[model samples]
Target: MGFTAMGLAQNSISGVIKNENNEVLSNVEVLVSDAAIQTKSNENGLFELKNLPIGKITLIFKKENFEIKSEEIAIGKQEQKIMVVVLEEEAHHIDEILVSSIFNKTQNENVVKIDHINLKNIQNEGAINLSDAIATNPGVNVVSTGVSIGKPVIRGLSGNRVLTYTQGIRLENQQFGEEHGLGLNANGQESVEIIKGPASLLYGSDAMGGVLFFNPEKYAANNQTEFSVNQVVNSNTQGSNSSVTLKTSEDKFKFLVQNNYTTHADYQTPNGETVVNTRFIEKDFKVGTSYATSRYVADFRYNYNDLNLGLPEEDIEDARFRTPLYPSQKIENHLLSFNQKVFFKNSKLEATAGYVFNNRKELEAADEVALFMKLKTFNYNVRYYLPDFGKFETIIGFQGMNQENRNFGEERLIPNAKISDIGFFGTSQYKMEKSLLQFGVRYDFRIVNIHEFGEIGTEGSFQKLDKNFESINASVGFKTEITEKITSRINIATGFRAPNLSELSSNGVHEGSNRYEIGNPNLKNEQNFQVDLNVDYNAEHFDFFANGFYNSINNYIFIAPNGNTIDDNFVYDYLQNNAALFGGETGIHLHLHEIDWLHMTSSYEMVIGKLDNKMNLPLIPANQWKNNFRANFNVSKNIKNSFVFLQANYTFNQNNVSEFETKTGNYLLLSSGIGTDIELKKSNFNVYLTATNLLNKEYIAHLSRLKADGIYNMGRNIVLGVNFKL
Candidate 1:
């Protein structure tokens, strides 16, 4: 839930490293993965760790031209130990240890398949925002309104269907609207793990679509201090992003702080047209601290974000406005999280409580706040890890949230409401020789209370009401290592989501959507069941994977035009129906054995959604094929870890569309980049240059709201970045 390093070492451990032939292996790397502790073997092939916590920890050893090795060990409260370690002279990939997904189990050992991407991989692609960064992954897409505002779409489900968690808490912004953006920044971010199917079995409701869990940067090494600075410049929008971070950790305490600032002008299209009122500015700040002993651990984290985003609904005659123009959105968010753990002799308890406040405003003119809303959410989770039994691991948890939404200003879209949710779940895993079985069951109860607003019987009016929803869900999964080089997995899960305020009681024209919408008060819950299958083949020089899923949903809610107009706005009605969606992703990675430094990757992804009546679902991404070829090598003694890459992504034409949507033509996007790491003694620096939309193809994306206005996405942008560390 918090940072991974939970150290409580009270004793000392020493070890000696050697090769198979019993020769001392100097310069070997030894690490405690979860504790964020590492040391290099001296010339004598000896390493020592002082004051380790009294628990089971994974010790990993690595060296050049050698296979990675790991051992699980338990430390006593008061003990001194010495050990010997031996390595084999071969090279192989090591599975990543997951922290939040399923405790400390590696990816291969888990029954549920997940997708992960390092934040650096996203940055190296020159992504300007988190939404764009994650969209590069398979089975993921984004619905964009402009260059500055985009929402993540997973497996053709978006809006209130999917759930997002940051800092181990649910991120609640005004995301019920499709025009809203993910209120997140990458100031102190690390990597992200994605559960591609129904995750309600773990994270409760609204995760029927899936879950996006973001992990923050790990704490600094014990007894060490670190500082870094990063800056990037963009050519298309004349944008600039800068950030600074400082972190320090001691034997029993840790602290970290970071800040980020970003600004941009209007983005230019491939046709050399500047989209008016597309500028934005952002400021972000973060702080974190932790304390731990052998049996107790506590962590606290805080973040603040402020943003001003322009909305390009019309042209602005004035060209001198430096900040956002009229019809813009200003958002401010604050997050505070506290985590604690209590360890017994054979079991442990982990609990995290978080508070989030979001302030959102839409301005229509000079100093005019047409629509303003404030949302406050308090969420808590507690999980108890039972002592590991032979071939069995079990966990029981309880999760709940209390959310309040209030409105101000002239526009009233939804009524003021208070929503509460509580859920209890238990899950366990059974390990076998070559196969693993995992299952879980969850019970959820939710209540929504709406307060009346505006005049009775008029638009933007609501009556006082209260409603309750409950559900019981479960999941079963199995993973089998069919052969030495092959693995297969299958999972079946059920998920459900109660109707949101916007889908239940809204009766007005939403901001920026150019439509009059009406909600159905009697809408039922959306329940879904999905089956997922995955097969992977890993060999010496190649890796291949194929994934497929079929999902069936009941009481799916959709909005469509009813051939009528209210106040010159198209009248749309929210409707419900049974629906189905099926999709798959396949990819292959090849490392050139002869070339040694060259690698190639290719992948394709597709999804199709349909109602019971055979009508296509709206906003589904088109079929895609992506390819990348890269080379890595040491440039010189001073410049090391240098690389170059060429990439191409092709989006196939989308003739399949809903009645209210338009078809889009096919297009190809080309991009390339170069970068390197520089090490001058104790100081380090990194610099890179990347270009996107190399061919400047001016095509409208199928999922972009700007397509209705005949606007093209950003094109031919160059980004230059630099980093310095001390």
Candidate 2:
């Protein structure tokens, strides 16, 4: 019987349906268990079921190529209830859909080690940037100049070896520099996924080290429009961040837009002293739209970012503002992309194309531009899923990129160059009841052309230079269930990386790093072979995991001092050698079913990088241990989802160092936070307060570029954040 017959108030439930990548899925069937209510999602992946009784009920969501999701929801006396539902692709089905090359299977079924971080869970963890959020995962670290600049380091590798993808496009914004950040904002992102092993078979050159994938936020439910505002304030840097987002969806179209701005002053140290010129200002805007049907899907996205970064100087005047002085940099980036998917009766095809333009200018004086460069890149990819043959699922893909770099300033670092790449790959997976086997192979070719330029200083002018590189890579992996509670994965992969433009043509001092760098035109491609193993065990109240990897690289490139001086600066030249790196991470989570609100977790990670001569590599992160205790509770009728957490982090002394690096002492850090969701009249809000480095500890990190200047990391920081929805 309907609620109207009983004279009871009718409530409505509405929500959006999405995949693991946060992309909307259309044609989904939404049904209420033990009821006659049923509905189908529209092209925007939005669904609604109205005229429901005020009670607890189960909602089932099912679609082709995706796993069926069932959620139990409580309907109050309110007129409407809004929700966001996420569905994962089915890996064991004949019509499985691929979210990404790294996340093709479930976490337990994948051969490689992958970690996922939900932004909502860590929003109150005192993270200021995307890198900060990612660092919470085991075996993941950050190389930083200061709080304003950070780069992700997976295992023990970074720089050109690590690849980042957003909006289904590879990001290229002069990532070869040590002082450059990721050029992305943490706002408007749903989650982040990290692949800790070689992924060159899927992403080509830069995937030799690892891959970082950012998932965008989903659209609003059908016939609904919503907006949100978020604000954050930090005491350490006197920083303020604000962002706003608006999303809406109709029957066949969905749109989302967001804008964010951040400003900060010099960060203070534990000793009550501020680090001068360590401030930055950033502005970002993003817009996206999607259209989906039963036969085809189309998506478009654009992002614009502007940054003003300060260069650290010794003995500079301290101020609580972000006005960059001399020797600063201004960078602007624009990215546009379009993606399409076609579904047939028994097969599917996907295509994506993207373009990025980066403009960077460095000022050494009030009115003079020392360095100005522009980088333009175009990327394209296509993949086709073939019909299932017997018990195997296969995919064939092609990917390529065309890039150009131009200089327009007085100082020239690397010559103008054009780069082109092409690659072809195929992969297959066989799924069984107790075991899964996966393998893939790829071949890539690259060409680089450099234009001649006049010589400067002791470096000779570059003649017309042309180079070509080719590589064949492959990977084989297996996942098996040993018992009802244990699982294991074993993988062997080969990856390669071509030398970047700076490593091939630099001829002068890099002012940002305060070192004279020389390039090696004769350098060859770096090749690596690695083996990874992962073991996992799960019980009713306990979870444990261990991951290990060993990598060997031929022709590994590094910069070394040549025992010479250029204008009072030490001269460093790029060199190549055979190198090896081995590392492992382990963690355990304990929860008591009797006390479901209490949880305890601990983890440890260690890595070592060495050359063929037994010399350690520079900038390797120190071994670290982390432990956390959290409690969840409800305060009263007006407050819910309340939680308190305490965290302890300890870093072991780094005694293993390169000849050019120094050892760092061990230290410990303490952090804590509390947050809750508040219910108001016709609205809801979230508030959080976090304290980092609660003890005001002073410490130096091994991977911190500022360590050379005897500078300590940021001191105690108190952060407050609030979110409002309308």
Candidate 3:
């Protein structure tokens, strides 16, 4: 792929590392971010990466107990001489490279502000699942059917408007249904990155709300084999989660396998009454492999998920672990993806493909299946990153997907349909001394073909239909430093989403909602324009950030009653109108420079949505205020990285609501945990104990779908977990 790869020349780079005392450092990890090339320093503090492309590239050096170093270097036609670098002891956790960013820039350097968090940090905060972990971030919430089933709501938007990506591919699992969950497990993932605003210019259609990207765990170090296991126990629900991962890596090849199992009984409230039929079980298995050279890289991953979930109605029972009763759901999901990258002397090209299979079944009785369907999707993406033009960088890409849905049960929620999507986009970034500018344009076309269902003119029948939708979207952003420690960023973006089948072809009795639903085949696409602003101040021991956004949407889709009834069910119609939402988040972090062992953090976030007629939108999250205080201490040289924290979360009363919604009062909850690590010969062991809803608060959340039934969220639950590796 490169000149050196073609045998026309040989290009190489070497480096040496040392400590402040001028002593040699061994086992230091040296990496080239863009090229996917890495090597470890030998006993002599020397590392070399050969067959590199001839151009400017970034190098990263990392090791435990030392500050990370990022260096920019240029490689010429010939072999490079050794470069020397010095490392200092780490004072605190600092910035790390963002994997989901198109340019691989850190948070401080990117024009668009992104939120990133590690899974370990989330676990320590008393999060028992993926949904709970994501909701800990600012400006993000979840719409929960129960403790086991939660859907992410980003900036007041849920359903198909938000996109989920894992292993560099989209995740599709009938997410348009209100009762559908995220269909993801947190077993093998390393961290998560969230784009809080519109991302349609980078992703295709369904990204009007935002993007959730999960980064998988890394393989073992070169020429090493590792095995890791984790076990978690939850008190209130009597749940247990267990996982094991094994990995082996050679110089250029790596392989990994992971297995996870989770099971929970009904969750209990403060009064000790369990929410009946809230139990669930999940079995997840994942495999991954990769091969890389200086000029090329290839990776593959596959995951299979099986879930058995029970649906709660007007019932209460004692907590117990058992198989789900009637009115339960069984979901099976499969995902496989492969990607490869080629690096030339001055440019790079990447191609990726993925396939997903989803089978969902709703059982009404032991022998009766009320609904069953299968959805298959195929996705592809190709991109070319042009060499730098002075200080400008550019990328052109094509993305598309083909999907189909089929029903196998007697009842069909929507007609069998085929969906296709195609989009082309180009984005660019320009760098200046103290500022960066980014802008992009994207064009997308989507087609939905619905087949006939049942009888044509009957009450329980649907008609055949075909629709096409297309839109052009664009985004622009700028980041600049106003002072040595103060920075500001502004981004404006336009996004769009094609109507899903449920909105375009529904003509049936929806039992879950107790309404006779009707669909409008003439519905248009939902489009929106949003503007975001962020400011940050970083001092020696204190840092503050404020983020705000305003979003306006045209042709917003919703359902409403029309003063009619079918078999005691209210008749509702699908409708559209203009709507707007605005919100912001502000937070501060104080490191307590005088006392290196202590640090504090706090934040406030809120969002409000209203239609053009001034009617409030449904399912909006109430205002929230969160605070945490943490302290770290050292045990012994062999047993380090110990920490403890206490946190308080308060939700303000939500009086503003739609006509059909009820108001929710304010509530506060406490959480805390402590963990430490012990090192052994080629092994490590860490343990932690955490508690959520520490005070056993009995209050319902404003955004919970179960709020109408007066069901409270999970109460005081304690968790114990351990991680061991060898």
Candidate 4:
């Protein structure tokens, strides 16, 4: 239970190692870089290193089937510190893993471009939703109807083209709707990994654009119990959010539970105008349990979410409540999943099954429901890993899903439909001394069937429709270290997406987007081919990275206006054409080694999307540049990790417009924040104060759906948050 001393008046470090699942990991190797002090964790996942220099030092943790983790610490004279270290499971090397990539490899080794967002950093930014949190990443954007409704857009693609996965299952919460958010809460989530390009080789259809993978929080360590309470308050909308989480683990069983509630009033514009029907309320609950043994492991999770969201298309005089008025939506979602893994000597078999139910109702008047839809989805996946032979490792997998959509309200925008999908894929990786190569291929088949209702040839009736689609997708990539300080990766991949129900069957006015829409039953699957290149350089004081991509799509589907209107709403119809997109992102990080507590970072991103006729795509984000300066300071014993940061974001004028879209002007915004961790008795607290839009600028984002309505985005706002751990 103690470190063996090698000298007098020496410092010591003791810690425990746990895997991403929060399970205690034994036999983990802990080492001091460039030092002779090294030890392995015991059966209880505890290790100690004694007689260490009383200065700055770095510790490295390594284990089989897990990514190597490194942490830096500062030790005082004759100081004894206890630490807790967490190791992420290697996506490509672990027996059972959930990742966006096909092969288990670190970010530096993966050929495909990927980005990771730490939730702690997002929380510090005072993000209101998951989309807002992820928007900080380069090459990612968000499309929003209002503050309460936002969806992630990768490059220039969104909606059905992008896929979202949680708990190792594809989320099926009626994503085909234009105004639907991701339907996920930010609490109880550990981190997010974004694949910024086509990823159909691992995930099947609907990944023609990219993928957003959310990893759930891990359980507590063995024989450990922990609880936390968090609260956040926002000024712009007079909003408040509170959450509580409890986790405990025994010898072989681990459990976790979390509950969160959020309520917000109508958001105020920079011009001091209140946009009515912008208020919302949400409740989320999550529970998970896992049991593990040497040869078998089982895990189960369940999540429930209820939301009351308002749809604001026009400005109203009185808007300051938390309840939705007329023209609002009540949505309820439930997700349940179970996963099993069988571990062999050198290979593993993993199976996962999930079910999701989504109920959505749109109320146009008090006690009257105008639109209601129920969606049910069942999905399953199985993957088998073959024993590694030499330097080659292979995995084969199969995935399938069945979905049904039904309506029970007075009006229906889309017909009742049933959809089925099945796909098979195989991927392999070869590792060399300084290079890694990966390749994968997949085949997918989908079927859609629409039921007939009312009369066959009436405006309010629909005829029976059946459609089938089949596609073959493939990908190949390579990662190589060009020199001791530079690395490069190149990837070429193909993706496809089947036409969604709204695109193939819609025949009426949609109130959500305020458009009269028609569908094309003969639409084909959209296909895309993309090539990506990434280069990076890492030195002692500086790090730099550049990413570029070119994508070409065939049979691209879009809704185009036909110069007509129905009941004062613009009329649009689904159409197909050839399109292309090209973009790149570059960034640099400079570490002030001499000062050791100062840093500077900057990045720029640009993208362009157009059809074959040279017409620009609608709703594309404008080019942007971001810069940040941060300073870290040493504090007293009661305070830890104190820091302050200043940031500036500039968006260029978006002159590129489609035939029916208007141009948007440019704007700049400034933000700053300060935070610190406090220790009191046996408990700890994290407190932060953040200010956004410090200049109180009035501007409209080019991608905002409210831009056409002449409504500005949120203005200056202050946020205060605190977390107490017990």
Report how far off residue 85 is in candidate 1 (Å): 5.4
Each candidate structure's TM-score, on Cα atoms with residue i matched to residue i, is: 0.95, 0.88, 0.95, 0.88
How well is each residue in 1-726 modelled by candidate 2, as lDDT tens digits?
A: 012122224467777888888888876878654233456787898877765444445577877446667665555544576678888764321211124543255465566657777676776899877887788889989999888889999889998989999888899999988878899888877778787878898899989989998766666655467788999999999899999999886655778899999998888999988888888899999999877543556788899999898889775665547786567789999989898876555566779999999998988877899889999999998988786788787889999999999999988777899999999999988889988899999999999999988854455355567999999999999989999889899999999999998899888888878888899889999999999999988776788999999999999999999999988999999999999999999998887778757889899999999999999987788999989999877789779779899999999999999988999999999999999889786567889999999999999888888999999999999999999987
Model 1 local distance difference test score: 0.85
Candidate 4 lDDT, 300-378, residue by residue in tens: 9999999899888654445447888778899999999898876555666889899999999999877899989999999
User: Which stretch of 10 consecutive residues in model 1 shows the poorest summed lDDT?
Assistant: 1-10
Candidate 1 Cα misplacement greater than 4 A, ranges: 1-9, 12-51, 59-70, 80-94
Query: How many clashes show up per model?
Result: 4, 0, 0, 1
* lDDT scores in order: 0.85, 0.83, 0.86, 0.83
- Model 3 / residue 364 / CA error / Å: 1.1
- Point out where model 4 deviates above 4 Å: 1-45, 48-98, 315-320, 456-460
Which is the leading candidate under lDDT?
3
Worst window of 10 by summed lDDT in candidate 3: 1-10
CA displacement after TM-score superposition, residue 155 of candidate 3 (Å): 1.3
**Candidate 1 lDDT, 166-235, residue by residue in tens:** 8888888878776578888866878888788889988888999998888877676666688999999999
lDDT of 2 at 211: 90
